[model samples]
Target: MSGLNIISNTSLTMFILIGIPGLEDANFWIAFLLCFVYLMAILGNCTIVFIIKMESSLHEPMYFFLAMLAALDILLVNSVIPKMLGIFWFDAREISFNACLVQMFCIHSISAMESTILVAMAFDRYVAICNPLRHKSILTSSIVAKIGLVAVIRGAAIMAPLPCLIKRLPYCRATVLSHSYCLHQDVMNFSCADISVNIIYGLIIIISAMGLDSLLIFLSYFLILRAVLRLSWEVRLKAFSTCISHICVVLIFYIPFIGLAMVHRFGKRSSPIIAIVMANVYLLVPPVLNPMVYGIKTKQIRQSIMKAFHRNATRPELFH
Candidate 1:
């Protein structure tokens, strides 16, 4: 408890993070478990990126999009998990005002980029399964690079203003944060200045970015469904099989994200621990599960992973 250096008054330079609230008795175990999940997520996402990079057969637009998704997952996880562990393990919960805003930007911006990439992936799957003939020609290398660049720019462009907005606000009250990480919504709650602009802008950003992407993804799948229904039963199954991993990944990412958003928006009266846990799920589950889902459902990725391992195992110089 000695590390809980809470400051008061308008001159407060640090924001104290109460990790897992009522779970202080279990933060040791919690830190250990979260550390394990963080490792798994890092390892899984890294493996996905490495496999896609190495396997020449996977050099297509689909795998390229997947590699981008995996990379986003790695960045997203790395942006917060280490700071979270610091809170739990070392009582290093005191974050300077500027550092908190930076973390907030990283979390939201990376999330925006990830959402954009997922939409790109859905479009790729739609092209591959719904209109196979035009898939390769439509999704060229140059086009894919442009899409990746757009994702980066869009995320950075949209989230870049958040830190500035937070910076302009004066913190006249308690600056303690609820979650282990600094979220835009969470940090804005402590602002003593009028936050209506922040609230409205944040809502607009969510609606325009993630909300629009979700709708586009739904529209893509609907069209694909209609196209699939027109094909023969076996071909339809095969087409759907190609999309299964992506669908799982989308569901895992969006469901918890939606839940966390709902909790922040409507469940303010709910338990803080619930929001804490939901936030963790929103952040942690997708990275840890995405690669596993892809490895299981996509034969090329699975074989590539095994082949990667086997190739490493056969090297004799390592034994020396």
Candidate 2:
């Protein structure tokens, strides 16, 4: 395959993706299942975003963060699943090198942005619960917008170098990616050039951006916990209840994320099944569960969703 000069010397063109196993030979059942999950994920995230937008009462900092998360989740899942589904349904899995780079950049950037937003959410909760007197002033609408802008800038700064790093590598072998989408590490591994610098830079970004963000989230929650301890029993319970949804979201995202990183770093490449499963988990699970966790755990969001649905169904003429 390398001997065939299919790709032009100057042009880094189409690359082959080794898609999920069993799909190539499986019947319609597999495709159906994936399609079902994809639809559910899109519908769930969209509904959450709509509920947040329509409900005037949810125009506060916490719900603002939740809406940001829902929007990110929609983008995050769309980045990978559409490509994967294309591979499964139509056997159209080939992605251009440039397309792959774009996908990688979007996925990594959005992931970083989501983590930063979570940190911002934690800070908002801390202020709301621990210092209610100053909550209104501290977490103003302008402040939340600033936090979102910072998240976008931070995400771009962290992931902007990744595509450049991948593109600079010498193409000794025909570019064959082993995943559905262009993951940064997966693409780097296929490079014929030495990847020591790329790996080091990647680690630095992860540790400094995501790792540091996680630490700050923990610290914020720790302070909130201390404050909760100082409060009366009823107040402590109320504060804890408000945070349960965020805590669930944090666990869902970080656990699979850390586990997948560990598996890819240490596990054997021969176990493609494990890699595929872990990749899907990291990409899909958080998006699917995020809206549900927030909707069910937070009374305000639940009521808002119900009210939105009722209004839409009952007052269709008003909406039109």
Candidate 3:
């Protein structure tokens, strides 16, 4: 019995995820704060999805992708934040090895999917603005669905190997993750086994997918700008008005993403904190800003939100 107990005690079980400093170390307050962020993110994204779904006028391809983006944001945040909050609230910061891998897979997968979806959205906008006559045929509902499916499959394919790589690693030290979540890079750093392959594959996947996506997005906008230049002043202004919000959103998403990558590659090991903060930004910032961006820029969504609120306010009492 004693030998069995020793074996059990020695077995690698839980990983300690060092959450954000300060409040995270204090107590449940940190958990509360994280929970609040989670709730806000969920609610915000859900509202976007609901508004897009219920409003027939938003049945266009762009709105369809926006809805998908919202749904992905909800999935991405829920997967990481709940587990992270649990780490803060409970003493049991130890997540199972498999669980850690799963978290990393889900987070990275959804992130990649979102990136791809943004690229698709950029392409959709380019087609709409540059070749207005061909918009309908170019962006049919069937084509949109196909693109969404391709995004999902590509995301899964890109991230699927990560968990397998992690599982194969032999952890020599106590598995204490340095961040609030099961980040793939953090997990890889803990491995006792050689991780040159893992590092290479991770960089390749991130650079090839995200890097290429951002490049395409920039090229799309460049073409869009050239097209805008050819138009009359009134048409150019209108086009810019429609596109400025999306451009802002793309910048918000990509700039920090590239910065984080560069920091990770060149900066000291202590830079994980920066990476963690940026990771949170990548996950949370887009969802919070998305509705606001679209709401201000999109006439239909704004009207729908107003109509929704007015209906709620004027509804008859349930008791009656």
Q: Indicate which candidate wins on lDDT.
A: 1
Clashing pairs in 2: none
Residues 1-320, candidate 1, lDDT per residue (tens digit)?
23344333335677888888777889888999999999999999999999998899999998998999899989988988998899889989899877887889988998999999999999999998877899989999999999999999999999999988877776644677888889989988886657999999999998999999999999999999999999899998998999999899999999999999999999988988889889999999999999999989999999999998999888987788
Question: Which candidate has the highest TM-score of all?
Answer: 1
Candidate 3 per-residue C-alpha lDDT over 97-119 given as tens digits, one digit per residue, 9 for 90 to 100: 77877888998899899899999
Sort by TM-score, top down from the best: 1, 2, 3
User: Mind giving the per-residue lDDT tens digits that candidate 2 earns over 1-320?
Assistant: 55544433246676787766765777245667777778878998998888888889999999999889989999988888888778777888799888898999999999999999999999999898888999989999999999999998999888999988888776644677778788898888766657998899888987998899899999999999998998899988998999999999999888888877877788864578888788888888898899889989999989988887787688868766
Output the better candidate (1/3) by TM-score.
1
**In candidate 3, which residue ranges exceed 4 Å CA deviation?**
1-11, 22-27, 269-272, 317-320
Name the candidate, 1 or 3, with the larger lDDT value. 1
Estimate the TM-score for candidate 2.
0.93
Give Cα distance to truth, residue 192, candidate 1, Å.
1.9
Please rank every candidate by lDDT, starting with the best: 1, 2, 3
State the lDDT at 312 in candidate 1. Answer: 88
